[model samples]
Structures are given as structure tokens and as C-alpha cells.
Target: MALIAIFILRKRNSDSGDRQSSNQNPQGLFSILNLEGKLVYDEIVRATNDFDAENCIGNGGHGSVYRAELPSGEVVAVKKFHSPLSCDQIADQKEFLTEVKALTETRHRNIVKFYGFCSHARHSFLVYEFLERGSLAAILSSDAAAQELDWSQRMNAIKGVADALSYLHHDCFPPIVHRDISSKNLLLDLEYEAHVADFGIAKFLMPDSSNWTEFAGTYGYVAPELAYTMKITEKCDVYSFGVLVLEVIKGKHPRDFLSSISSSSLNTDIELDEMLDPRLPAPSRSVQEKLISIMEVAFSCLNKSPESRPTMKIVSQQLRT
Candidate 1:
């Protein structure tokens, strides 16, 4: 690991610059390796223009993300967080550490690559490999972008996310539960391939611990069980994944549709074609049959009882078949 110490006398002229820089800790520590740490740091700082609003691409619960191009002509996503040394920023720091920890422990093709991170007294930021297509939510929200994501591409996205979740839940030494999994957290590359991002609230499913914690997930994406019990498990992520798959199939959130299907009074024999996004043409027969199977797996993940949800490994294998 490359450790570089630098002084941050100047801060971004933004709303996050409320606290004054202190002289006691003249130099802030930057943890990144082998990529010319100081030079990369300087390039990122200059490229972002002190994290100007124009460079910002998106805002999330944790921090604002900026798009930056290094001198090497490499484009990257820089997530500039609120100050970490301040009292009010304690929670932000914990979340930042959580992301760093989670990303460092696991790696997969369908997971965003963490290039480096800076934990400065005046400012904190994480660098990630930039994806051209942006978030799944953003693309699905746009008619043109959604149309570009055809039936095959959509299926690939779902499979990619499932593969990543399987790696996290089963492959890792101490299995991880992504407390937050939503369309917004799933990014898409140029080919519309899904890459899971944002691990601010991820927790390790330590066998000894009950893993009980406060609710931490996107409103509609969170599992229903979280509302009644804080005890978190891998199943919470499964439920969120189920919702995401439905969102990918249908062009929007499936809240009303899911509720209607849950009721025995409503007709349950909904056609697979009817559930697909209307912006694109109907899929081929083979694709339609595969989609039907995928839909079945997704609905099973949404089972009210957490124990009934299939393990991510099973979901991944089924999708592959």
C-alpha cells in the first residue's frame, strides 16, 4: 500500500466546507498503492477543480460523486464525502470506512473497482473505475436509455447482479450481507452490464453475532421483515434483489403489481410478455421462456419468510441454466 502524507490547506468551495482546517494535523494520510499516489492525488484534485459542482455526476445518501479525468487520460468516479473529522460527520466516516472495508475484502467482475481512497481532515473521497452507462435507476428512468437496454441486455444485468451477490454471500470467508441493494446502487457499463456499487451499510454475517442493527436500505427496496425486526441477514439483500429484478423486467417499480399479486383475490396468471418493459419490442420465444424462469426465481426471493428465500448461489446457478 502506498501511503502519502499531504497538507490540505485549501478545501472545496462547497456546502461541505463548514469546518476550518486545523494546524495540529498539518498533513492528511492517503492510502493507495503503486499508482504514483501523490501524482494521482494531485491530478484528481486538479481534474475535479476542487470538486466543483460541474464535475459532480450524482448525489447519494453518503456523499456526492464526481467524474474526473486524470493526466493519464483515465476517467474515474470520485466520491467526495463530507468532512470526516467533524462531530457531525462521524456517521459519514463510519459509512466511508464500511465501504472501504467491504470493497477491500471482496472483488468480482460485477462489482465496482475501488482504485483508491483519501481520508483527509478537510476532505474525504473514494476513487472508483468509471462506468459509462451510469446507474441502473438512471438508465431505466430515461426512455431512450431503457430502450437501448434490450431483452438480452436486461437478462445479463440481472445475472451479473446475482453472480456478484453470490460471491459476497458465500465465497467470502465471513459472508457479507449487503444491507443496501437497490437499482441506484447497481451501475451499468457501456454494454449495460450491471456492476454492484455502494457498500456503506454492508455488514458481515458473523456466525457468533446475531447481526441485529438499525434499518439501513433504500425505502422501497428494503425487506418487509426489517420493518418489524432489526435482525439483518443475507435474506434482506435477497428481497432487495427480487425487487430489482422486477424493476428491470417491468419498466418501473413493481410495488403496486407485487401487492396485487400477493392478494389471492387478484388473478395470478399474468403473462410474462405483459410484465416486460413496453418501450422495447417483445422478446423472442427462447428469451421469453428464460424470462419466465427468471421471474419465477425473483418472486421466490420475495417470499415473506426470510428462510424461504433461495441462497444467492442457487439463484446464480438457476439464472445460468
Candidate 2:
């Protein structure tokens, strides 16, 4: 009986040690939250009133969005996803694990910061730092915001997105591909710095992974090659980023122009000004040179043959120049 009591005490001690070590480790987000700070789940519930319908910001292919505030009086955006268990079990696990894994491990200025997540039998949600300006899509969609998005802001924002993508594709150990790179996924802070979001979730969402049931992207942003080919590669993201860059400068998606250039009948070489968004004036000499190079790189990324497209590292270098 004494021996049994000793064994139970030992087990309890071991369990307590494990818990204490976990809290001390500079990993598993206990460290990060200590640095930039953490938004407690209970406080967030109060801020958004438990994600009341009135607080909803937007809806997406997989989830609904809500705006919440932190104890520090800072606002944030949270995405609450519908249980994929109702539709596809495999996808639910992959997407939840993918975003959670990617954000937990990676951190950069251009990358969106993941505060934390909550997953239970009834609720699944991700918390992210809020951008006062909201998505690039919303800004461009509004007449006032589009008008205010001047050339300088536009150029910087483009570089911000490029830098973020480059980090994901080259800087990371295994590299990450942001399967979704549309305007909606690019959010800007008050200073107009762009942070890429909605990354690391794509393949699993496709029913036929080998050959996607469909292109699995916003209509205009989907790479042209996806029309005939089903294979997904990092270049697909490069292609999408290229379109996104042009869209930022042009104040809209560039589907018509992409189609025109792709047509066998039309000459690929066209005046850059011809495609400029009318809202913005012609680029300055330096800006013009930069825009020309960017457009060329965009063209290369949009190449129908995925092999022909330059890797994002190369694209990042070109943008820096």
C-alpha cells in the first residue's frame, strides 16, 4: 500500500512538471503572446458579443468574418468557419491544421499575424490582428477609397505583397505557397502596409486533389493554365500574385487584358499606359520604369506553361530592382 501511494505521488509530480515546462517554453505561442500580447478568448467574446450576427464583417468560401476588440482596446478580425465535418472530413482537418501550423511557426512584417484559434466540437475560429482599412478588395471597390489609393501607396502595397510571398516561397525551410492571392486576401493597415492572409489552405479543399474538380480560385485570378491542366504548383501562386499586382495598379482585375495578350491573334507587346487605371495619372519616369518591369514579370508568371514561369524568388528580386 505504501509503494502504491509513492507511485501515485510520482505520477502527479511528473504531470505537474510537464505543464510547467510547457508554459515556460518559448514556443507553442506562449512566447509570442507574451511579446506582442495575447487576446483572451473570453475578452474577445465580450468585444464581439460572442460573434453576434450584427458584428459580421464579411463571408467567404469557407467561413464568416467578425470584428472584435481586445482588452488593450485594439480591434481584430476573426474568421469562424462552418464545420467541414458536415461536408468533407479530410478537408476540415487539413485546413484547420494547415493555417494553425503555418501561423504558429512563421512570423514577418508582411505576413498576417495569427493571435490564436479556438476549435471545439461546436465552434471553430481563428483570430487575427485587425487592419483598420480592411481588405484591398473593399478599398478598390469603393469610389472614395480607390480614388485615395494614389500611385505611391499602390506601388508600396505591391512590394509589400511581393515581399510577403517571397518570404513564404523562399525564406521558409520548406517554403509555403499561398494558394489564394486575390485582392480580398490582401489587407492593408492604417499606414497602407499590405499583409497577406488566407494562405496555406487549398489542396485539401479540392475534391480531386490530382485534378481539381474546378480551378478553385476567384474567376479572374485563377491561372490560365488551370483551364486545361489540373496539377497545382507554386507557380500557380506566382501567377495569381502577378494578376493581383496588376489589379492593384489598374484598380481592377486584369482578365480582359490577360485574355487579349494570350490570344494568338494579338501582339503581346502593348503600351503600358494603355492598361493603366484611369483614376491614377501616368507613372513618373522612375515609377514608369518600375511598372514596365513589373508588367513584364507579371507576363512571365502568367505563362501558360508552368515551367516557363520564374520562381517567386526571381520575381522578388525583380521587384526590388
Candidate 3:
């Protein structure tokens, strides 16, 4: 149902060569994705053992992803659209072009690195930098992983995610709306540094128009404004980030709190230590104060009014200390 709310907001948006989607259909007419014969199709097949089950890493609405280690010893992630996705030829072609255009135009430390892709008649796949630590969702799910995720580490991850969105919203030529920002989409490196991935074919908003389509995002993390608005804005991501920040510190989803907070009748004040993840020791006073301030920013992001949310720039600045 929460994912359904994000639906009111999502609009449209995929692969290319040296890179492309690992599908068999021809991607439609976006010039950037027209690498045609240049994508590394052979390597992807060899790396995934012909799409064997062993290499499969994760699956989602867009496609099934695999963690493939190529012959060059470089580990990369490959996302292949399922055979059943009902996209028209033109849309598929455009998705491919969108991926090429966006990634080629933007460069930032927090954004995921696109390695290349293959758009084919038999299989289509997107090659992206592989992150060993996996998605933020994976870590928060495991007892061992959650235990090691401390206060400082959690803040670092927040900053990384902020930086990625900042680049997408401010540095791109026309700017890009990720349309998808949740724990599942945020991958982590060996040191657990956040690397915002899954941008092969993200949606973009016009100068002043709200782009609408079926909603896209994980449950409990989507913005409430998206529940009724088709206009995608950076504020949508801001709301999701607030949820992520709370999820990281609490060691769980903040759905219950969201439910309670939305009611607006209960007292809102609470001790910081009481809400933090019990897996780790309570933070020092300085960190605790900072966390409190950060939480304020997070809550502000949750405002029902989209315009009330802070920009990624403001969010990143608040986390720097």
C-alpha cells in the first residue's frame, strides 16, 4: 500500500553499450543508447554463467540483478529486465537512451558508477559497479550487520546518500529525479560507504511540470505527498531520506512512529537514547545532540507539504558536523 502511494508520483523512464539492458528486444530510438554493436554482451553472459541462478543477487519491479565477477577480476552488477515487463518498443528504446544520457552527463562520489550495458535480441542487461556490502536494507536486516552499524557509520551513510541526490538534483544539465530512493536502492561498499545506484533509466521532471505514472518505491519509505501528486520533486526523495535516517538509527523501520506522528495528538518529545538502536551503546552527548538536530531535519522532511522539505543541499550541510 505504501508502495502504491509512490505510484501517484512516478512517471516514465533504461540501457546502452560497451553497455545496455540484458534483454533480447531492440531498445527504441534514444541516441545515447545506440551503441548497437559496441556493448560487452559476451562478457556479461560469461560472467553470469548464461544467467544461471548462482549469480543472482536480487530482484525488483524493474528487473532481476546479478553479482558477476568478470574475467578481468572486476566484480560488476547486471540488471536484466524480466520477460514479462509490458513496455512498448518505443518506451524501451527511450529507457535505454535515458540511462546513457543521465550517467554520461553526471559524475559524483555518491552516485553509482555505470560500467556499460548490452541491448540485444536475446538478452538485455545493465552493467554497474558492484558493491559488496549490498543494499542498506540488507544490512539493517541482519543481526550481525546491524550490530556493527554504529552512530558515526550511520551518519556517514546519510551524508553519502545526500551527496548523491545533491548531484542528481543540482549538477545534472536538466537535473534528474531518481524517482526511486529507499534502503533497497542504496548500495554499500566494502567499508559500508553508501553508493546510490539503480540510475540506468531514471525519470526526469520538466522545468515546472509534475511527471506522473505508476508509483515506484519501497513500502514505509515513500513520501506521503507522493500519495496524491504525480509531480516528482527532490522533496519526494527528502521524505524517503528522513525515513531512512530514522530506520538506520532505530535499527528498524519507523512505520509505527510515522503512524503515531501522523495522528498529531500524542506528545512528540522523547529521549534520544530511548529511540536509538539498542544494538549499539548510547552515543556520546555530542553525537546525541547532533542526532537530535538531525532528527529535527528528518521530521521537517516528513512534512505533508512537499514545499516544506529541505533541499538535498540543506540536508547534507546539517550532516557535515
Number of the top lDDT candidate? 1
The regions of model 2 sitting more than 4 angstroms off are 1-37, 84-90, 200-215, 263-267
TM-score to native of every candidate shown: 0.88, 0.80, 0.82
Top TM-score prediction, candidate number = 1
Arranged by lDDT, best first: 1, 2, 3
- Per-residue lDDT value at 176 in model 1: 86
Better of 1 and 3 by TM-score: 1
Q: How many backbone clashes does candidate 2 have?
A: 0
The residue-by-residue lDDT of candidate 2 on 52-123, one tens digit each, is: 899888888667889987778788898877662332454554465467667876788988998776654455
The runs of at least 3 residues in candidate 3 whose Cα sits more than 4 Å from the true structure, single-residue gaps closed, are 1-39, 84-97, 208-210, 263-268
Each prediction's Cα lDDT score?
0.81, 0.72, 0.71
Q: List candidate 1 segments past 4 Å from native.
A: 1-39, 261-268
Tens digits of per-residue lDDT for model 1 on 143-172? Answer: 999999999999999999999999999999
The TM-score of predicted model 1 comes to 0.88
Q: Candidate 1 vs. truth: CA RMSD?
A: 6.6
